[model samples]
Target: METSAYLNAVVEQTNTLAGWVHGRDATAPVPTCPKWTLADLVDHVGATQRMVAMLVGERMTEPDSAYARYVPAPGDPAQWRDWLTGTAAEAEQAFASVTDDTPVWDPSGAAAGVPFWSRRLFGEACVHRADAAAALGLPYELAPELAVAAIEDWLDTLTSRGYWENRPDFADAMRGSGQTLHFHATDASGEWLARREPDRVVLERTHTKADITVRGPAADLLLVLSRRRPLSATPTLELHGDRTLIDRWIEHMDWVTGD
Candidate 1:
C-alpha cells in the first residue's frame, strides 16, 4: 500500500503486540520463532522500532556500527506495554517525517530510501504480531491489502540476486530447473508464480499453475510465506500438487532475517 498505511500498521501492530505482553507469561515460547521467548520478542520488536526510527530520522546513508544510546529497559514485563507503545510512536513519527524517496541505509542492500524501511518494517511487525497472537492463544488477522503488499515486498527480497548473494546457502537452495511454486490469494487480487531457474528465482503475477499451488487468504499466505507459520501445519491452506517442492521451498528459500 502507501507509506501512511504502512506506518499505521506499525503503530497498530506494535500497540496490539504490547497489549498482549501485559499480564502474560514472559517466558512463553514463540512457536513461530523458536529462538525467542515472549520477552525476547518484545525487546526485539521495540528495540528494532527505535533503531529504525534513528535511521530514518537521521537519513542515514550507511549502517551504524553501534546503537549504544539505547539501553535495556529496567522494569519487569508489566512495564513493556508502555515502553513498546512509546517506541512505536517514536518510530511512527520518524517514518512519517520522511518521504518515500528520502535516501537511507538498508542492511539488506535493497533500496536506499525510507520506503524500504516502511515496507520491511511493516512486514516484520505483521509477522511478529502473528507470533504474539499464537503465543497468547488469540486469533490473528491482517488486512488483505497489507498481506498482499507484505508478500510482494518479501518476494522482492527473496528473488533479489543482490540480497541472496551474501547468503550462499540460501542462493544455492533456490536454484533449480523448471521447478515452480504458485501462491494464490483467494481473498484479494494477489497471485504470484515463482519459477526456479539454474541461476536465480523469478517472481511474476499470473495464474499459470506451477509444480505446487498454495491457495489461501492473503493473510494466511503471508504468514506461511514469511516462515512464521508452515504451510503443512494449517489445514486451512490449500496445498495442491507437489508437496515436496512446497516443503523444500519453505525449508530454505522462505526466511528473511531483518527488522
Candidate 2:
C-alpha cells in the first residue's frame, strides 16, 4: 500500500472507532482484547498514534508514551472525533514529511522512516477497528491492497515482539527445527511463507510449501493470524497441512494475550 493510503486508513479507521464508541457502551468488553474495555480499545487506537507521532513524528530519539496522552471528552462523540482528528493529523503530518529512505528508530530494527511506522500504525488501527466493530456488532472491512499490507505489517510486528519484546513465551513457541507456515489470501495478491526459527525467523513474501497453510480473505487472514478471530469459527478461512503446527503458532503467537 502507498504511504498516502496508510495515512488515509488512519483517518478513516479513527472515524469507525469513534462510531463504535458512540453507539455502544464504553464498558463493553472487547473479545479481541479480553482485558480491554471498548473505551480502552478506542483510547488505545488514538493514544498509540499520538505516541507514535511523538516518537516518529516529533523525531524524538527516545520513545515515551506520556508525550502522546489524550484525554477523551466525556459524553460527547464530537469530542471523541476531535481527539482522533487532532492525534491522527499529527501522525499524518509527521509521516508525510519524511521520505522512505529517511532513517528512523524502529523497535524491530527491520523497518525505517515514515514507511515503516505508517504501515505499522495502519495495521494496528485496522485490527483494532475490527475489534470495535466486533464489539458493537457492526460490520468491518478493509481495502484489498490495504488488507494485504496490514497482514504483512502484522507479521513483521509480531516477529519484533517475539524476539525483541523479551516475550520468552512467544519466543520459545516460535522456535522449531524447520517448520513453515503459509498465509494465502484469496481476495487479493497476498501470499507469505514464514520460516520459523529461534535465532533467525524469515518472512518470505511468496508462495511456498509449508507444514501448514491458512487461506482466507486478507481481512479474515489478518484477524486469524493475529488471533483476534478463531480459525474454527470462520468458515471462509481454510486450513491445510499440519494442524498441530498451526495450532502451536496460533496458541502462543499472540503477544497481546501474554501467552
Candidate 3:
C-alpha cells in the first residue's frame, strides 16, 4: 500500500471509531480486549497515534527515549472522540511529511522507515476499530485493499526472525515437521501459505494445498488472524483439512502481542 492509502485508512478507521462510540457508554466492555472499556480502547488508539506521530514526525532514532517522551490524554471520557480525531490527523500529517524511505524507530526491530510506521498505525487503527465494533454490537467492514495489506503486514511480523528472537517460547511452539497453514481470500486475489519449519516460520504468497486452509473474504480473514474473532465461529470463513493444525497455529499466534 502507498503511504497515502495507509494514512487514509487510519483516518477512516479512527473516524469510524469516534462515530461508533459517540454518546455510547464509556464503560462498556470490549469483549475482544477483556481488560479495556470503550474509553480505554479509544485512549489506546489516540496514544498510539501520538506516539507514531512523534516517532515519524521527529524522526526519533531510539525506541526507549521516544516512548519515554510519549504522553497520554486526560482522563475525560466526554472529550475522547475529539482527542481521537485530532491524533489521527496528527499521525496523517506526520507520515505525509516524510518520504517512505526515511529512517525511524521501530520497537520490533523490523524494517524501520516512514512506510513501516504508517502501515503499523493503519493496522492498529483497523484492528481496534474491530474491538469497538465487538463492544458495541455493530458490524465491521474493511476495504479489500486495506484488509489484504493488514493481513500481509501482520503475517510478516508474526514470521519475522528478528521478532521471534525475543519470543523463544512462541518460536519453539510453532516449530514443526513442515506442517503448513494456508489462507485464501475467496472474495479477492489474496492467498498465502505459512509453513512451520524446525527452526523458523516460512511464509509465501501462493495457491497450494496445506494441512489446513482458511477461506474467506479478506476482511474476515484479517479479523480472524487478529484473533478478535474465532475461525470456527465465523460462518463466513470456510476451513478445510486438519482443524488441529490450524487451531495449534492460532493458539501460538495468540502469543504474538501488539496493538
Candidate 4:
C-alpha cells in the first residue's frame, strides 16, 4: 500500500475508535487487551500517534528522551474522544510534511522512513480499534482492502528477523521442517502462503497447498491472525488442514498479548 493510503486508513480507524468510546465508560475493561480499560486504549492510540508524528515530522534518526518519558493521559471518557482525534490530526499534519522516502528512526532498522511509520501506525490503530469495539460490545467492520493491508504488514513483520531478535527461543519454536500455513480471504482476492524454514518464516502472496489453510473474510482473518479472537471460537473461518499447526502459530504469535 502507498503511504497516503495507510495514512488515510489511520485517520478512518482513529475516527472509528473515537466514536466507539464517545460518551462511554472510560473504565470499561477491554476483553481483547485484557489489561487495559477503555481510557487506557484511547490514550495508547493517541500516544502512538504522537510518537510517530515526532519521529516522521522531526525526521529523527534515533529515539529521543521525549519519546521515552512520555505518558498517557488519564482515563476521562468525557474528553478522550476529543484528545484522540486531536492527536490523530497532529499525526496527519506531521506525516503530511514529509515524503514517504524521508528518513526516520526505526527500532528494528529493517525498514526506515515515513512509509514504515505510516504502515506501523496504521496497524497499531487498526488492531486497537478492533479491541475498542470488542470492549464496547459493538460490531466491528473494516474495508477489505484495509484488512488485506493489515494482514500483509503483519506477515511482513513475521518474516523480519529483527522482530524475533529478543525472542530467539520463540523463533526457534516457530521454525519447522517445511511445514506451511495458508491464509485465504474469502471476501477479497487476498491469499498468502507461509512456510516455516530452519532460519526464518517465509511468506508469499499465492494460493497453494499447505499443512493448514484459514479461509475467511479479510477482517475476520485479521482478527484471528492478530490474536484478538481465537480460531476455534470464530465461526467465520474454515479450517482445511492441520489444526495443530494453526494452533501452534497462535501459541507463539504474541503481538497483541505483549507476551
Which stretches of model 1 miss by more than 4 angstroms?
65-70, 73-75, 253-259
Ranking by TM-score: 4, 3, 1, 2
Q: What would the TM-scores of all predictions be?
A: 0.90, 0.90, 0.93, 0.93
**lDDT value, candidate 1, whole model:** 0.81
The total number of steric clashes, by the backbone 3 Å criterion, in model 1 comes to 0
Better-scoring candidate (lDDT), 2 or 3:
3
TM-score of 4: 0.93
Q: What TM value does model 2 have?
A: 0.90
**Predicted candidate 4 versus true structure: per-residue lDDT over 183-224, tens digit per residue:** 999887899998998878888999999999999999999999
Which 10 residues in a row give candidate 4 its minimum summed lDDT?
Answer: 250-259
State the TM-score for model 3: 0.93
Backbone clashes in model 2, listed as residue pairs: none
Model 4 regions lying over 4 Å from their true place: none
lDDT for each residue of candidate 1 in 197-259, tens digit (9 for 90 to 100): 887788899999689999988998988877777776777789889988888877875363222
RMSD, candidate 3, Å:
1.9
What ranking of all candidate models by lDDT puts the best one first?
Answer: 3, 4, 1, 2
For residues 17-136, write the lDDT of model 2, one tens digit per residue.
Answer: 765576457778888788887767767778778778767765655454435455543454446666766778878888887777666666776556567788888888888788877777
Error of 2 at 161 (Å): 8.0
